[model samples]
Target chain A: EDKVVQSPLSLVVHEGDTVTLNCSYEVTNFRSLLWYKQEKKAPTFLFMLTSSGIEKKSGRLSSILDKKELFSILNITATQTGDSAVYLCAVNLSSNTGKLIFGQGTTLQVKP
Target chain B: SAVISQKPSRDICQRGTSLTIQCQVDSQVTMMFWYRQQPGQSLTLIATANQGSEATYESGFVIDKFPISRPNLTFSTLTVSNMSPEDSSIYLCSVGQGTYEQYFGPGTRLTVT
Candidate 1:
């Protein structure tokens, strides 16, 4: 079965602190890894990483994928209360069907 | 990126009742999918709504329980039949814009009493 696992199921941190969320996957015909942030409703797209060593960044958030290691990491710097949300990791297989295997997600709480 | 929206953002219903959720996309998409997210659980693909054809359901999901209709490339609907307390979940509609990146709608929150 295709599985995506995330570490630190839940985390609490103070504002201004940096946090790192981890995602590891085991699937066949790997294609790309994506990160999303869910506040109270829909999940907003964050990053899509397909290459190793290279990092994709957006403002204070960044992510990287290590295909060989079958893992990825998302980093948030100088976090604020608004950054509190459930971070989801999903792996897209090469199956032309465009199916996504998602992780259980990491719930992050940034307190002021 | 495509903008997606869903109707009946949240609904509270009694057991044995049914609900139909609608999904609309700003742009025509080739692929539309329905997913279910149980409380505190990850999202699971329910089926692939194929335009002009019967939907392809995922394992553990049946058409009789969750019938889907894709009338066009930009619109789709999922009907949950004979609902039960265990059927309470958040149903999300996502569209694939010719890539692996799928954009999701706000989702329909269902609560069965």
Candidate 2:
């Protein structure tokens, strides 16, 4: 079955801690891998990785994809309490442009 | 990126009642989708609202229960019929931005009593 798996379901860290979230997928064919941060009711878009090795960075958040290995990782540097949220990884299938297969997500708790 | 908006950000409705959530996009989009997120669970695709046609539902979802309509490229609506406690979830609408990304709305938090 096509699925996206995220590692370290939950994590607790103090401010300034760096964390790496893993996402591995087993899908027939996919177009891209995406990351989002859910702080409350809405999830904010983080990064979209379509190419391998090339890391996409915004502020302290960065993500990279390994298409050959069928995995991706999201790294957060210098985390803060404001970064406490569920970080979700999703695979955008190549066959379907409107659907997203989401992982269980990693709950990151940043303590002050 | 599309700016999506959903109506009735949060609502508490009694069991068996039905609620319709509207989604509007800033520009015309080719694909509009509806998703449901249960408490403590990840998001699940409910259906894809096709413009000028019947919505396509995902596995385990039915049209009679979750009817969707896309009257135009920039707007869509999802109606949850005969709501149950299990139906209480965050209903979100997203528009396909370009070919790889989907921009989501604020979402409607539905509570069933």
Candidate 3:
């Protein structure tokens, strides 16, 4: 079956620390991998990686995809309390149905 | 990016009752979906609302329990029927702009007493 697995279910770190969140998937016909940041309300889109080895970055946040390994990693540099949220990774199938298989997610708590 | 909104941001209802959550997108989207998130859990796709057609439900989710409506491309609704305490969850509506991107609404928090 198609499934996405994220490592380090939960993590606590002090402000300014760097943390890496991992996501691995096993699915038929891989298309793209997406990352989302979910807080109290809803999840917000973070990054979508379709190619391997190329890193997508925004400010202190960056992500890379490794299709050969069927995994992805999200890195946050100099984390802040505002960065505390559940990071979700989802795999979009090549079927083009827009159906996403999501990971359990990694909860990051940045303490000040 | 598409802007999405949902009504009844949070509500508490008694068991056996039902609730319908509304999702509206600022732009016409190609696909819309309903998802459920239990506390501290990952989001699970409930169904895909197809415009002018019957919604396609996922495994473990039935139409009788969670009927969906997609009257148009910009709007959809999901009804949680015969609610129980176990049904209490955060219901989210998401819109697919194209092949790779999907945006989520604010979500409705439902509590069954």
For candidate 1, write residues A1-112 as lDDT tens digits: 8999998899999999999999999999898999999987688899988899999999999999998899999999999999999999999886577788899999999999
* Candidate 3 lDDT, A29-80, residue by residue in tens: 8889999999886999999999999999999999999999999999999999
Show how many residue pairs clash in every candidate, following the order shown: 0, 0, 0
Query: What DockQ, between 0 and 1, does each candidate earn?
Result: 0.73, 0.75, 0.80
For candidate 2 chain A, the 10 contiguous residues with the lowest summed lDDT are A92-101
Residue A69 shift from truth in candidate 1, angstroms: 0.3
Q: What fraction of the reference structure's interface contacts does model 3 contain?
A: 0.74
User: Of the candidates shown, which would achieve the greatest DockQ relative to the real structure?
Assistant: 3
Name the lDDT value of residue A76 in candidate 3. Answer: 100
Distance from true location, Cα of B47 in model 3, Å: 0.5
The CAPRI classification for model 2 reads as: medium
For candidate 2, give the lDDT of residue A105: 93
Q: Write the per-residue lDDT of candidate 1 for residues B17-113, one digit (tens) a residue.
A: 9999999999999999999999999889999999999998989999999999999999999999999999999999999865568889999999999
The TM-score measured for candidate 2 stands at: 0.97
